[model samples]
Target: MDSAVGRCREIRLRAYPDGMIQPSDLTIIETALPEAGPNDLVVRNRWFRISISTRLMANPDAQAVEGIPFPALRPGDRLADGAIGEVMACPPGSGFEIGTFVSHPLGWRDYAVVDAGSCVALGRGPIEPAAYLGHGWTAYAALTRGIRIRRGDTVFVSSGAGAIGSMAGQIARRLGASRVIGSTSTPDKADWMTAELGYDAAILRNRGSIADQLKAAAPDGVDVFVDMVGGEQLAAAAEAAREGARFVLLGALTAELNVAGASIVAPVQLDSFQLILKDVTLRGYSADRDSAEAFPEWIAWQREARLHFACSTVAGLENAPGALHDACEGRLRGLVMVEV
Candidate 1:
């Protein structure tokens, strides 16, 4: 153990958020570090991810979100998620050396005492600590395994400027899609998607009917739909889907983050006729299941600079709550991370 190490600061849920998360809903507290067990490693977290899933987990009433293995948080409980950290203390024979950077599940804190089995060593490389927190694997799995982006397919991703959606657009293009389109809340974000994220077109959800905008963007109809922000987007994508199209259901940000007291079962209206007449195949999968296979491929893409990591970074642990709030509210683009 480092002689200078002592107590650590962590963010905890102050209350279950009603709808939009506020900074006041979380509090930072100091506590003594836990004693390291024989198989445990103490780490100093460098960066922690702030995501919509974190927002969903903060809701005590929200049901267990699919694909997230962690339990829902209660008042005074520490917020936990993907984090990159340097090992400070580890038991002999733990196979992890001090100063090794590792990715773990304990986050929203300055330090963590995690099981050795849960930590994945990130060798010193050109990849930054924050890059390890990117949702590239999620996007990779959704594109490759969820539906398999076919050559010449026109793909539409909802919330294209989002953490996963941003990566989805680029990956879809790399997977041989002829045209990639994305829908975002603002024109600025839509422009960001088309200009920077390799999208052929961007649809502004705020400008007019999403269906109308999508129709104009893909007049030939979308061959693949990556539905992230459900509700209106899901309905619109269904309407604009081409014959024999594939729909990959990812997240439901609009209903989950916006509507107060909305359950995971929030109703998504889609035309049943479109599904049958167009022979559209809608599929949803847990990212966790595909991560094992997707991580290696995603890493290869990163090393080759074939993928772009769009990220918004906040400098302090104290600001994690507000960063998360921004992420949930669609103010931040791509993966939002906090430097702890």
Candidate 2:
């Protein structure tokens, strides 16, 4: 009989207090393989995986995250969120067939053993499956929730050229946003969004005050703000928001990363009580927390919503460290997927 062996890439946590992900924060341990138990299918290492919140990054009590339980991947860890590789073999009577590609929670490893119950077969799509994890779903979620982008309502998007941001802008237009104003830190990203991605208008954050830019960008005031990083931008969303506008606060990446940068920290003080008095609604969003039916409900609607995603893929399980570093540095966007 052939000896069964598996190579796995695992992330062991060290320590992180400032929310900055340091290289030493996670140790990648490669171990000898274990034979599949019971109905588990062993996927031959093809493309391991990379999701923004990798299983390791999400594991319970990740020091990098705020107030998480110790050892984050608790008994309730959701496997639907992870993706993996082609099946090398499945126990007889196991549902997965050899060569079938799968995405599951057993991530950060070259080879994964998934019970038939924990994984789902990938569906056919126009883009590569990696892109779906790296880019597709987050954008899918961002654009789907928020004030309706009806005709004549001006829309302002922070991180307009970012992984989820760029796709959100496109989807808003398709949903009938009259004017899509995108904000970026540099002219280069602004240009890319306009010249390449069909953006209606782009604003450079480096220019005059963000408030001024928004005023000029939307003389009528912005009806919606798709905010990914919520520091000053959250306050900016409040300032630039049209009366009764909705500010969708997503991830606070800027504040969470460079906590010292005043550009991100200062504005949140709120210029005055007039901001809240304006009747604007500011709500935070977490797409992962969904009702049982809600997941399928939106999944069905995305077909008509027409969302887009982008992914950066790295081959070989060992390259995950470099990939994570690139992602933390903003060199990579959307979802970073590693092929085990």
Winning model by TM-score: 1
For all predictions, the C-alpha RMSD in Å is 1.7, 5.0
Q: Candidate 2 lDDT, tens digit per residue, 275-319?
A: 567787776665554222344554555567655544567876657
lDDT by residue (73-159, candidate 1, tens digit) is: 889888898999888888898788898788999989999999999999886544465447887778788887888788999999998
Q: Highest lDDT: which candidate?
A: 1
Measured by TM-score, how close is model 2 to the native structure?
Answer: 0.77
**Collision count of model 2:** 13
* Model 2, runs deviating above 4 Å: 1-4, 14-25, 45-81, 91-94, 123-127, 205-208, 259-267, 271-277, 291-308
Q: Local error of candidate 1 at 313, Å?
A: 0.6
- In Å, residue 278's CA in model 1 sits off its true spot by 1.6
lDDT of 1 at 136: 75
